[model samples]
Target: MNPIDDMDADPIDVASHWCLQLADGRLQGDALARFQTWLDEDPRHRAAFDTVARTWQAFDASPAAPSLMAMREEALSHYARRQSRRWRRPAGMRRPMLAAVAACLLLAVAGWGWIQAQPDVYRTGLGERQLVRLDDGSQLSLDADTQVEVRYNHDRRQLVLRQGRARFQVMRDPLRPFSVSAGDRTVVATGTEFSVELLAAQVHVVLYEGSVDVLPRDAATSPPPSASPPSPSTVHRAREMRLVPGQELVAGIDAADARIREVDAPRTRGWESGQLSFNDEPLGQAIERMNRYAGSHVLATGDVPSASLRISGTFTAGDNEAFVEGITGVFPVTVREEGPRYVFVQRPGTSTPEEKMTTQ
Candidate 1:
């Protein structure tokens, strides 16, 4: 019987069947095609198969595996003997049944092992980038000066962006949604691509593909406060927002301010390629991002209204000199060398940069 035809069969059982066939080098040609079709038909199929395959590989290295195998054989033999007397089944049919039983036993052991596993932490230093391939086939691209903690179990896959930024290309697991928590907000996804940045006073979420729900982390899990009724602003701050591709959502870390706007999603990922692309971004925020890659930090000082100055351009990640020149050339801003740091101040006898630039 074709395995795929058994639609009512347990997914784990089908996965175990494929694992066994592949392990003994039985899947080839048409059998390989069928396996691929089944895998692509549902995300859960691939997830189950990965779990079973990992368990099969781990079995050889386990110290108690020999004793466990002995116990399984002893039990199978006793069952086979009882079955032979009752139904007198053919030996050929019994062997397949015995193998399926063994696979389920192995899966049970794998589940216990997964529950005992510890969370993994990944970090990147200043001006460094790291690409991490998770066990479940998801990929994480960490930007400079970033730290993330990944915890995966049978129930869910969770990550915390401790600092900085990272992009996630999540693998689809219908039973387990992927979630990344940054500050008080959490971005939840299922088989999607998105980036989450923990800024100084805001959490920025940019969705590149699929959709994500940005919500307060405690809203769903924590019990409602009983001491006093929350103000309207407090309730509004805790409200969830859904983001689609090409949309950017910025939520305040210390304030109840949140806003969403259309953005060039691809431009937001320029940092992954050692490029910083900004589209009318605040000068201070852009400078903060540049400092992540700079040996000498850039500081906005003096009577310069840096907050009101917006910059638009693309610059190399670590090119501090070029960034300084770019701003000085366009805006009425002067760069003063102060040891290793560069201080930006308003040029003498010049109008505000934004007003001057707008007039031109």
Candidate 2:
């Protein structure tokens, strides 16, 4: 069989080979044209190339490039010595050596393939985030302190969001359905780009592209209540809430009706760029978001009207001090230390407590 057959069978492996060739800076004329043809032949080719390019860009931007380059050089030199000795080995040994080399190359280019081939749990620590590309071409961007359990089968793809938020870009698969379960709520889609956030007692689903059906697990089994409600049967039916692009569905704990609203999808994912954007968001809710990135906690205190006031701005994630300063600067509020937690209340002369010490 031709060596190129292996590459033709797996586009990501081929993309990795081409990426290495491009790194050598020797691709020209006919070679570049052939590469372009390969990319244009299939959509998977372009996706693989984009993934490889992003990996290269990340490596270039990282501070550990020097040590990583040194490791690469050492690995290459060792491989060269092995190649020189391989020809002298027995015929049986030669096949194993070639297979080992192929496996190593595949492992290098598509590490995520091996990871997603089996059931796996991916998680991120406090203030940390992760980008994961699954074997089916779906990508998951997990936010800080998030945990997800992934299980893929021939029939369907399933993910359980144990905690925190995640942005999912799912590839279309007609035969298999993709679903994410957060608490009792499950958001199902064939192919879509969306985000699911699990808060203390709420599950927020934001759709950036395509459509998804957000339903409760016990929707079908439960009957509609007899009380004189505004929407009689909407709450009992789970498939009622279908989200399109730029639409968000907020499902509160034990709440019959979910609130659906329009939002700026890009701004909703500002955490991906290490920033947070709020557009007239509640002060309490804003503080809770900041707390997700900060080790220290901040809470709203007293019957302060400012706690429910609308706040709008962008701030760097994990900068608790700057967030407090911004709050005091704009809203009529003051920050005070209450043991381990920071309390936000209405400014002095009100019923709320006076500021003991300012953050900044």
Candidate 3:
């Protein structure tokens, strides 16, 4: 066999080879250390290894696993007999060849099964809050009109948020990182509780407990400017930011106006329990959010000045009437029914001098 073939293979292919070796349950001492060192050598190596692990884990979850394992045992015995008869083959080469054969046996049995074992897609209707429990004991709480696709492999747990908001309570797995992709950013964690919301071009992240790293989608693929890349240990060298508990990171998909700031973590998740809390949020923005859970459309009209005013309060979701009444009590505006929509307009004769000047 040409040694150059193995050297030229991608890390993912190499990682799969290593996975097969470990599955044979024969490696000890030096072999194990070398595997660990290879994992630590590069982030791509770990990612590749995780992909192989995911495929294996998916097989374990399949109903055909038991029968497949039985076949694998039979194949191992048959291969052992064949190898015993080849006396001219070097002893050192025999074991390595046997390992490769064992992996092929598994692939033959479950190649299609592995692809079918990908995670399920979940969605919630408007104004609905649904909770989902994953196979790995992790919990996902999806907010109104939300969509998420979940996939767990032996090496990593991943979720893709297509839109809306969701809270994640991830179980701890040191070897396999948990990541959620939204817009142009990926939020990675080991074990933590957090919430993510997609608004316009922004991916809003709130870390309630533990820690998470917000990274650009291409952070793993793009190498640095220099000829040599940074070591895997220097994870911070990538264009990423680590967020601690009680912090918020808003990443812009356009790569502009991204910001990290502190917030009341409890208030951020209040929507999960039917409580909507806003802290000095703009009236227009607040109304748009509340409309997510509302049946009757609330429209801003007449005086645009009041739309930019800051408002703060806690109200129940779907209670648009109460919210409008509350706003009118404090602000110089009134809510009136116009067909199917409730329009907020400036109160008659209440326009400020600045507003009048601007209008003229």
Number of the top lDDT candidate? 1
- Per-residue lDDT of model 2, residues 1-360, tens digit only: 211345434554566556545544444577776777887888998897676555544444562688645644444344434334543543233446544543444344444343336567999987899999997999999998899988987678888899989999999996888888887788888899999988777788889998887768555223222333222113343344677788788887666668777788888999998887776666666666777787565455445554356677788888878887777776567767877677776776755423222221
The digit string of per-residue lDDT tens for model 1 on 166-279 reads 999999997888899998888888799999999887788899998777778775343223332222212245466677788887887956666777788888999999998877
Model 3 off-target regions past 4 Å? 1-119, 220-238, 297-307, 348-360
Check candidate 3 and list the clashing pairs.
54-153, 54-154
Name the lDDT of candidate 3: 0.69
lDDT values for all models: 0.74, 0.69, 0.69
In model 2, which residue pairs have backbone atoms overlapping below 3 Å? none
Locate the minimum summed-lDDT window of 10 residues in model 2: 224-233
Model 2, total clashes = 0
Full candidate order by TM-score, most accurate first: 1, 3, 2
Candidate that would win on TM-score = 1
Model 3 C-alpha lDDT per residue in residues 1-360, reported as the tens digit of each score: 211134555675556556555555533567666777877878988787676555455454662687756644454455455344443443333656655665553552254244437568999877898999998899999988889999887688879999888999999997878889898888888899999887665688889998787778767333212323222212233476777787788766757445677788988899999888776656766676687787666555445564366767788888888887787766677877888678887778886312110100
